[model samples]
Target: MDLQAVVDSLPRYGEPLLTTIVVTVASAAFALVVAFALGLMTSSKHLAIRTPARAFVEFIRGSSAVVQLFWFAFAMPVLLGIQFDYLIAAGIIALGLNYGAYSSEVVRGAIAAVPKGQLEAATALNLTPLQKMRLVVLPQAWPEMIPSLCAFAIMLLKASALVSIIGVMDITALAGLIGSQAGQDRLVHYSVVLVMYFILAWLIWTGMRALERKAKRGLGVDVKPVKGRLAPEVAAGGVR
Candidate 1:
């Protein structure tokens, strides 16, 4: 492995790295919103609301994510008679739709796992449905949802590489370009790319861990920093 090739490729990665970061951030934000909306709809008392949300979740989850990207980038333009200038928006939509479907289940399960007694108490207090969710349910459920949502966010970051196929020049695409030209140093180039992805995922995980701790603290739960990490079972919501 020629370390020199890896060093040479690093400088050219700056622009592509920015593109990757933008796509990941935008897609994750979109996915989070979509996840919460669909998750909440799935729990609605109205069969009319729950049925379509559940169906969309299952449909997106069952299909291939790469195929979805292709549909947005290629098929949609042909069908709609519109062409995207950069293809960034289409990639973000594809990633958001794919991961959001999966993350919605995490949200649904977390919301459902909240103590039934709390729901009854909220009802007895004569709280409106929106108030019940905002003041009672979401505050409890959001913390429980964090870990799974973190996992999905990291998956979305790695999956952002899929956009390279549609010609968006993200880090992975640039790394592939470097590898092809580096002859015997292909291994070195790709090894660097692998490490770059790991670092990005690690950063996202660390951020989410902090968020979990903050959410627990908001509920007055004991949140001791255990060796630079949150203590296990902090989700149990043990009071200080």
Candidate 2:
């Protein structure tokens, strides 16, 4: 293995790595918002509200993500006559819309998992529909949603590699470029790239695990304490 080639390429990855991280984070944020909006709409009792949201979720989820990215990058400019000056923005939207559809199912299922008794109690207490959802249903549902959302978010981070096709200059794009130039050292270069992606995915998983623990704790569920991290209970009480 030509270790020097990998070493020399490391510095070159800085900008491309940043691009990948930015796209993943922006796409995940957008997907989270869309997931909640569509999930809540689909969970509604009114057919009028639920139908369109369901259709949208199915359509986006059914279609190929690459096709969706291409449409946003190429077709959208011509059809909508609104060209995105930053191609990265278009890539982010496509990833968001695609994964948002998948993640919405997580939200819908979690909301449905809330016990019927909770709804009954809310109604008996004369809580408005909105109040019942806000105070009773969602708190219970949110903890369930986090694990699936984390999975989908990690999937989105991996899928962000597709944006390289649209010239966003992400990690995969640079890795491919470097590999082609390395000839005999191609294996070493690609192996390093694989490790880079794994590290990124692991970071996302760790962060999401922390969030999952926090969400479960809100419901008074016993969560194994995180090592080397101060608990909220301890933090609030301050030092003895």
Candidate 3:
């Protein structure tokens, strides 16, 4: 690969990279909030409250995210007679709904993983249902939910690339533009964008790993330290 050629190709992609990052971060935050709300609603004891939330989650999960994106971009305005920026609306609706469904499952699993004994103990203490969830269950569940949440966030980030289909000019779109401009150097141009995405994904993974370690520590879970082993002489000295 001609390294200089790839370097030269990067400027054309800068805007697209920025657009992708912004959409990913914004959409993931929105999705997290939506997921938490809907997930809780789905777990509600009242059939009226739970049924719709459960159905929504199931429907979103069963559908194709790309198809949803296309619907939002093309069909929504016609159906509702309201216009929105294609990229912004797509980011908000597609990612928020798609990841929200996945997050509902994560939340449900986390809540289920909370031991029945804990709920009983809370009830024995005369705690309200809300109190039990707030004080006893969610604290435990949030940490457990982190790994899954991180995975969902990564998926959302990659899926944000699909916004390019509607001419959103996200990272993938920028790569396509660079490929067109570079002609025979298309391979080098696209390679740079690929490497950039790989690096971004790696950084996200590393950050999530650090967050998981911190959460484990906060929860008083034993995390084995990576360090030098204690010598037998030192152990004997301490025992003495």
After superposition, the stretches of candidate 1 with alpha carbons farther than 4 Å from their true spots are: 1-5, 182-184, 225-240
TM-score of 1: 0.90
Better of 1 and 3 by lDDT: 1
lDDT of 1: 0.90
**Local distance difference test, candidate 2:** 0.89
Instruction: For candidate 2, write residues 126-150 as lDDT tens digits.
Output: 9999999899988999989888888
What lDDT tens digits, residue by residue, belong to model 3 across residues 52-161?
Answer: 99988888989988888878888877998656755566656788888988898888889889999999999999999889999999888888888899888888888888
Q: Whole-model Cα lDDT per candidate? A: 0.90, 0.89, 0.81
In the predicted model 2, the residue pairs found to clash are none
**Lowest-lDDT window of 10 residues in candidate 1?**
230-239
Candidate 1 contains a number of clashing pairs equal to 0
TM-score of each: 0.90, 0.90, 0.87
Better of 2 and 3 by lDDT: 2
